[model samples]
Target chain A: MGEQLRKTPYHDLHVRNGGKMVPFAGWSMPVQFRNGILHEHRKVRGSAGVFDVSHMGRIYFRGPGAVAFVNYLITNNLERIGRGRLLYGALCNHDGGIIDDVTVYHLGDEILMVVNAANADAVWKWASELKPGDVEMVDATSDLAQIALQGPQAESCLAAPFDAAVKDVGYYGYAHVSWEGAQILISRNGYTGEDGFEIYVPTQLAVPLWETLFRWGSAAQLEPVGLGARDSLRMEVNYALYGNELNTDVSPLEAGLRWVVKLKKGDFVGREALLAQKKAGLRRTLVGFEVAGKRLPRHGHPIRSGAEEIGVVTSGGYCPSLDRGMGMGFVPPELAEIGTPLAIDARGALLEAKVVERPFYRKGSVKR
Target chain B: MEFPERLRYTKEHEWVRVEGDEVVFGITDFAQDQLGDIVYIELPEPGASLQRMDAFGSVEAVKTVTDLYAPVSCEVVAVNEALTDDPARVNNSPYGDGWMVRAKLGDAAQLDELLSAEAYQKLVAELGG
Candidate 1:
């Protein structure tokens, strides 16, 4: 497994700091550190936590046709976004099926797409096929490393490193700042539902930057987080994961990402199919439910409405914050209503569950 | 990782201590350390019958879950109700307050098949615990 798995630039640092390296999306990533997922999670919620997200793919689109090509490929309307703003949307196939969920950063002249690690190569290949000759596509995944500083103290922790006014970067906004004479990109957004910054730096500076953040943010109790805590954090906020919620088989509408789908905006990939899907109505929709029992509903677990198996759990686990077994899964429209009673068949035992409003842990300081 | 000398062990990483006709059991320290920050635990109720090597309960950590196997056939006399409210006890005290179940021993001969502290340590070492 180690031979096939790819390591990030901070691999040595992760191992030295007791990050339990595990196989994830063809990359060997730290699932959790020596402090454990619970500790790391509380650190992010209470103070600050840093994540080495270099494993995610960064594809840059440049040249004359860059904006037009990106506008046509993604479901969200890019014309609404200005330079230095970030947009979250999905790349859908012509049939309205989600190809991959992406976070597109409008960095003035170039567009940087941060895609999931599992779908990096696949996304690149898919885009390359549709890429126009005028647009130059460059996969900068190996050239640069990304770090996420999350929590309420994220601004202060990140601000200590640079003289630039990082606090000015509003939610879903970004700015280029210089640290140690090297220019780096800092985006005020994250998946943890915290006030955070996603830093993009050159590969060679990854280690020094990681060390500097810890040194600067030690007073705020910032620690290195891993994928395990990352998953739990996102689940708490009901954020959709790549294979879990948004997949090739599911449409973005059914995955509860209708906000990103701009039907009024000009035609784009999956526009027709999505319009057709809208006319036909969604057969199954994603719903958040909490298990009443101690046992958690895991992925692929059967979800039942009375005695009949209605749907399958797309993502399920014990939310450390909520202190309950909660998860999101696809169920029929009739059963997707909040307050609807449901059940998760955990092996032979049927745990009582109920559909509830998303973001199982709500008190996130995402905007503030 | 404490492997108590008086306790008997299984390859699945459960430990049992025999006292007269009854036995007390729980997961080993190494097992808890590997599982990391247990959030929930599912255990059989009192009076539940168990067979040797049968899954009597399960430990749910944040990332994954594992079944706790019964070391010997017995009737569950009581369960550690404290774990329901505070599951982290298993991580904080795997050998002490984290004890899962108290049961009446069905066969005294099954104890011979269990590994001693020294032998269990070797097994843990082989598994890179």
Candidate 2:
């Protein structure tokens, strides 16, 4: 606990707002705020909320071969997503296992790839090693601060201060605009399954921008949310987290992410292994399930068919939106079908659960 | 934040209030504060026997679950029914309305193994501080 954990630019600000700091990855970050996770989660769904996402690794890919290098390193079809588009995909190992789930922003001149905080260093090193001589990779994490402003009223809350014209930004689209006289990037996509924006700004202006947004959005009930609700919001929408659903031990195919893998678009890392696995057929697949009772399933909790431990939960918790327990787990292909019943041996108590469809929380205002 | 002076405490952050031959126990305020909002609690059924320092229940927070340990040997006499529908009470009124179980003491002398109010305060200062 005494280890000197890295602190973001907004670390002290979070503490001032009653954030309960916890060690996440290599940084001391807020897990929850004064209002607790349930309140913060619902607030984001109803009005607006802000989250400090500066902990994620931000890398810049520039030069002639940037797009080709990115296309070769990750599974997403970059050719289909033009400039100013945000693409979500994963970098995989040679064995077809997920190295890290990443989000790439096509900035036209330079490609900006955002990776998980824990996997940033390793992924950067991996990318730097394999990069062609024509491409240049630069780590810009220390110079930038990223904030996710989310919810239905999220845009209107800050429409005036940061610019009100962002309402026209399409889903997965971003705009590089002048904010408070300085240039910054604002993406329409958010992790909460809500209509919001992810803004990137210089590190020195982080606090000023935060204060301005909060001051302007206070009328709209803009709360400073922590990572606790950020996790639940993403999980409810079936977004795969790097450590939970996507890891080196799990393949994208097995994790229900086959749509992103571009087999027909040419060669990439892990392409051969994924091809072989496709032909071999999948033995296990990730499935979402709804628990029958209040006994919530947790990560590593065993999933059972009667007495046999068939699989384990990757992410599980109370879905405050549904007012019920929800979970995601890996089960045999036979048990992966919708409506198939299973049991979660949470700690020791057995709770009945059934396989459900993706995006467990369907009322998200993502399109709105 | 405030530990009651009348109750005996465990290093695990459990408070025991001795009443007649029955001893009622619940997690201390410090424990509940540390746990954040308690979402669920699994308590041992009434009439269950527990040895000193044995785990009889657990409380789940948003991110973690903490097993509740018995401070002394006892027979479960009463279980809190309110907590099933409203686990947040443990965070609201951790000492009073949040009391988890009532048990008949196996040996009243086992209370000696617990830290006194003063001793528990010092322990918390040294540990959580």
Interface RMSD of each: 0.8, 1.3
Identify the runs in model 2 with alpha carbons over 4 angstroms from their true place: A162-164
Report the lDDT of model 1 for residue B98: 95
Candidate 2: share of reference interface contacts reproduced? 0.44
Per DockQ, the best of the predicted structures is 1
Ten-residue region with minimum lDDT total, candidate 2 chain A: A158-167
Candidate 1 whole-model C-alpha lDDT, 0 to 1 = 0.91
Q: Can you give the lDDT of residue A140 in candidate 1?
A: 97
Local accuracy of candidate 1 as per-residue lDDT tens digits, A170-238: 899999988787889999989999999999999988899889889989789788999999999999999
Q: Using Cα atoms with residue i matched to residue i, what is each candidate's TM-score against the true structure?
A: 0.97, 0.96
lDDT of each: 0.91, 0.90
Fnat for candidate 1 (0 to 1) = 1.00
Error of 1 at A10 (Å): 1.4
